[model samples]
Target: MDLAVAHILSRVDVQGADVLLIDGPSGAGKSTLADAIVENWPAAEKPTLIRMDDIYPGWGGLAAAGEHVRTRVLEPRSLNQNARWQRHDWTLDAPAEWHDVPSALPLLVEGCGVLTRASAALATVTVWLDADDAVRKERALARDDGAFDAHWDDWDQQFARFVRDEDPVSSAKLVLRAS
Candidate 1:
């Protein structure tokens, strides 16, 4: 674990007003960092986590998924209300499950498009993680057990477009090189 990561994790005061967004390219260790934060969080704080992968429509629905999360989850949550969004079932190729997100302070959202310009304004802290392309490809495919192999190139193209449009790293509070 990076010392900076540990420092950030320790400083997160969930009981107070806080919303952490972890965003990066696929296989950049965004999810891993988010998990570490959640794990190190005080149990009494009851931090809530929302993963963009679960909300994403599909492999090709990256842009749509970002918009969906913004409208469905972030919008409502900002007003201190419980929000609901259907989770896409990848295997079934449809949304087969409903996720009722409780209104929890200091919410942690982690994924590729979680830190767009609009979303960044809502987050108290945003961390961007990135790794080399070869490492990213290897980690991503292995993590998904080859399920994302076919879509790798397509997704990478979309991610590049998103980076060009949003420049999420520039908007982030911290940028970490995750190896």
Candidate 2:
């Protein structure tokens, strides 16, 4: 996985011509990989990043959030227009703010469901990450500090359905075992 990201970084123009999507089930190290990429990226060519976690409506809004990202972010970005989308505040259980996604190239979209077939077609590269289920569960719980305990199973189920339907890994340019 490290080498894959490194290779992708080497090929990036860094002057705004790439759009990478990193998708995987929860605890599959998507965020970690995203962070690594950004950290290693040249400071002069930093890309805009959007985490699906921020876009999701709630614990049960995975499918809807995926659609939201497609319609509100990726589509408009493809047309070279600002993407207008709402951020759902989990605590308030409502739309909290409107984000005007800048016309930035080399965008990095990272999270589960971020690399659907439709979105993948628009990306310069797509990476799919995976890990053992037990490892994923342990990592997720530890990261969230038990706050995600009740929602873990629900999110996992959604992830399974998403993988079954989207087959994101099959479409990816890189498939990584993040374990």
Candidate 3:
């Protein structure tokens, strides 16, 4: 996490990065890394942080959420326009209220499926994080407190497809390993 923060700070300082994307397999520490980055951000104004968990419509919404961020958030921000996104109410299994992100400030998005080639191109910094499969599965299942138990295999298959089709690891500017 310290190394990731240092790398991101370096990019922000040297490249004037206004958009940062951190992506990884489930439970690979994307959320943890994002939290660290936000806490240690060097800028006077912190970037807006959005988690892909909020954007995903359901267990199978990874690819769709990625596209949503690309078209609604990253693309608009790249054009210097305000970005808007609708959160997914997981409990109700329906779309929820809209949220807006200011384009004038920096943005940090951390999630699976957010670091595809197109999205990476729009981002100032992109990261790919990975962990051992056993570790990731254990962490994810435990984090959700058995709520994700039923959907684990399904989610894994979908994420596998996303990884295969989008090749996020190759698209990322930085690739980090986590426990």
CA lDDT, every prediction? 0.82, 0.85, 0.89
Residue-by-residue lDDT tens digits, candidate 3, 1-179: 79878987788643243889999989899999999988888767888899999999898899999999999999998888878999999999999999999877778999988998999999888999999999999999999989999999998999899989999988888889996
RMSD (Å) of each candidate, 1 decimal: 1.5, 1.4, 1.5
Best by lDDT: 3
1 or 2, greater by lDDT: 2
Which of the two candidates, 1 or 3, achieves a greater lDDT against the reference? 3
Query: What's the residue-level lDDT of 25 in candidate 1?
Result: 93
What is the number of backbone collisions in each predicted candidate, taken in the order shown? 0, 0, 0
Q: Rate residue 26 of model 2 by lDDT.
A: 91
Candidate 3 overall lDDT versus native: 0.89
The stretch of ten residues in a row with the least summed lDDT in candidate 2 is 8-17
Model 1, C-alpha of 155: deviation from truth (Å): 0.3
TM-score of 2: 0.94
Which pairs clash in the backbone of model 2? none
